[model samples]
Target: MEFNILNQSPVLNGHSVEQSLGHTTELAKLADRLGYKRYFVSEHHNMENVIGTSPEVLVTHLLNQTKNINVGAGGVMLSHHNPFHVAEQFQLISHLAPGRVNLGVGKAPGGTPLATAALQHELRSDIDSFNDRFLSLKSFVDGTHDNHKVLKISVDTESSKPDLFLLGGSLSSAKFAADNEVNYIFAHFIKNDENLLKEVASAYKELYPGGKFIAALSVLLTETEKEKKAAKEENSVYSLKFKDGRTLRVTTEKQVNDYIKNTDEKIEVEKSQLDMILGTKDEILSKLNELSNSCPIDEFMFHLPTADAALRNLTIETLAPIHTIHKEKAGIL
Candidate 1:
């Protein structure tokens, strides 16, 4: 198994942006020292709690801070920018840290309506142009755009190009990724549906035939007695089904409130036992072994979403993969 950390650079209560950013940097260094494979930052806009608006900038700073560790975006929303510009930025990053950058792209807005409008001001058709945007981005990276006339990604022949990945929680996205023949990361933390994951995995494998697939999920490794009890409370997973057959796990009350505040989608709620693995080291290991045996997941990416920064850092330290298999190349493949 391969292990990597996905950081949101979360600003917990009473912590300033500088402190949160500093803490995240320290954690990325710790990950490198502990043999964690990669460090990817999340992206959000107009989110006071989530300060990572520009993943490209974060990747560059982290690349300067760490050596021999891969740094990339958890994703840059594909609809937000021109494909050629996005390709050029990451290609330059590859020059800075050759063979150590991954470019994951998603279709999510990564922000509220106002923020999306502001960020995507010139590209007004982003909402309905995700597939087209990805195709163009891929063309630019693969040096097939304009019949090789312009905007070619100029990476060294010996070095790996910026890895391109499509990230999403929906099967529609999965099929698109497989059809396009790029890597894919399934966000189980967003939907928490194992059957859905397996369904997409099967389809993607059959369509792409030995392509890379990453399963990104959350982890909560607690030690204190109070922490154990509190972690269980966080596992009270609820599902809200919308009229358009869209369903997502509502992990926090704020998510529910935001849904109600933003849209008029009539929701039918369903409560179920949480399927995630979260506990002490032994219990979590057992669950991991079982998952590895039962599922065809290529690699597991862990994200700790706790507001308690100390505990979050501790979890990464304790779960550091001292024994996971290492690959010669940089990607999940």
Candidate 2:
């Protein structure tokens, strides 16, 4: 019943980017004090709502601010940067917070086509070579690369390597993580199919026993009907599947229309409910327990969907690990 956090640093309702980022920093410190396991920030680009464009910088700041709790990128989209640089960045951060840093990588572009193109303009590798890039990044992080031929990452050898996690929603991604002997996190908030979750978990476990399987879900801890309604209104997402087998998650219809207008590739748009868990603290805990029972989820990472800062803080406080532990000890959970 371990809990972690995935922050998007959304700039909601005309809030300034600095405000959003400041909130993220404070909440991360709160999560650390509450005994949460990890606080991972997402990487998104060219999105007005989300301002978390650089997760490595955020991870570094969070690591410096918090006394305990692992901090990292929920994922660094691998298609936009050089793998060697990515490995070197995280490896250096690991020295700052040894045994408390994570490096989760994903294949998604994490932005619109224009931003993706801009980011990758200088890189030699493309999205098609994501597998090879991920392997090379892993080798560099683990110090398994040939130092005689390739430049080493050159970090403190005594510092622990950042715990690697592969972030994806597909069974293929699950197999890929298992095959590589890395941890896997299913993006349940993006695509909440119960059967698919079970199948992916089973497949990963069958291939790599004892590997960590985490489910990242959208959650909203609501205290009133108005709050619940507002959260749901903001919770909806659209999954755009391109003809070339790429999928993009966008929040607004305007984004969908913009993508269609910008790209020449054909796409199929599917509006998703996002499967947000909206309820009181007790109800949310009950649903979480039920979900964990149904699947092989070793940990639950929450992606709070509300834009209201007050509601976000309340939700974090309500479900903090310390509160859960206290309730369990008192036999009231």
Candidate 3:
């Protein structure tokens, strides 16, 4: 029952700009009112289907409306943007939200390789430099470091760095996150191994010295049985796209089903390889509790596909109370 809530800023294809902005703002207000801890938007670019290319802009809009909910990138894909620019944007967010901001950084390129290359074409593509970039970003925001004297993130505050989290789905990322003292956010939706969650969490803790490990899950919660089943069916399709956006078509379920069935992979084997789940609330909560206890995460971020406001709201409404109770019992609330 004791955990933090992180709402995903998901995007859809059908909405107008006004509708998208309005829905996101509404979710932020609702999250604040519901006592959810933070709302994080993802960075996606050049995808005709996704609207979250500029999470900082979205964060600004949401912060204007919500009084309590912390808003920032559920992850800002560092691979695409300049570290300094990212820092400044988040610094501005921190200035606006103060103690209620977080900056979760992802090393993975969230878009197509072509798009990734295009985004980073001007910058060095040294993945190893992420560590340096992260350090530089922190220094810029924190206004610290003797060797490097840089402009403070335009905020002039010592604590403007905001809370930081290292996010990834691979074992390598878990190791790196642990090696560093930063918090770790395992994206379970992309790498959905429940056992791996426990393994990685333990590895992170062992190597971490101290700090929290956050597990993130992408889920859909439904009401009636019919609705639940329908949601599950729909979610399976959604999960396919989330996991692998390479599909040529979006409207065809047959393509997804065929892709799933024809893969040289067995169902269990493939499921283990994939990073998310599509199931009813009962099934979802069961797996989530397992990951929480097994991974012993300090917090859990729910990536509610933001396109469906109703389903997303229902997810938070139903799950927040349980998370709160669990947190209270565990003394984490």
lDDT of 3: 0.66
**What tens digits encode model 2's per-residue C-alpha lDDT throughout 105-136?**
98887888778778878765435477888998
Clashes of each: 0, 0, 10
Please provide TM-scores, in order, for all candidate models, with all chains considered together.
0.85, 0.94, 0.78
Q: How well is each residue in 1-333 modelled by candidate 1, as lDDT tens digits?
A: 778888988885567999889888999998998888788898887664688999999999999999978898889987677788888899889888988999999877676556766877776542456788889988888887776654355744236578888888887888899998998888887777888978877777778876788888778786577977786675676677767665555555676567556655577777765555677876766776676666677777887766688878778877777633442244442
Per residue, candidate 3 scores C-alpha lDDT tens digits across 1-333 of 333555544454466866766777787787777777778877765454556777778778777888877777778877677777788888777887788878889766555445665777787545547667777766665666454455555736665557888877767778876776778888776655677878888888888757778877766675567865555454433233334322121223443465445444332212222234456657776766776665557777776643666777777777774355545667885
Error of 3 at 251 (Å): 9.9
Relative to the true structure, how large is the alpha-carbon lDDT of every model?
0.78, 0.86, 0.66
Model 2, C-alpha of 86: deviation from truth (Å):
0.7
Highest TM-score scorer: 2
| Model 3 pairs whose backbones collide | 1-323, 1-325, 1-326, 1-327, 2-326, 2-327, 189-275, 190-275, 191-275, 192-275
lDDT score for residue 332 of model 3: 88
Kindly state the number of residue pairs that clash in model 1. Answer: 0
- Which pairs of residues have clashing backbones in candidate 2? none
lDDT for residue 267 in candidate 2, whole number 0-100: 87
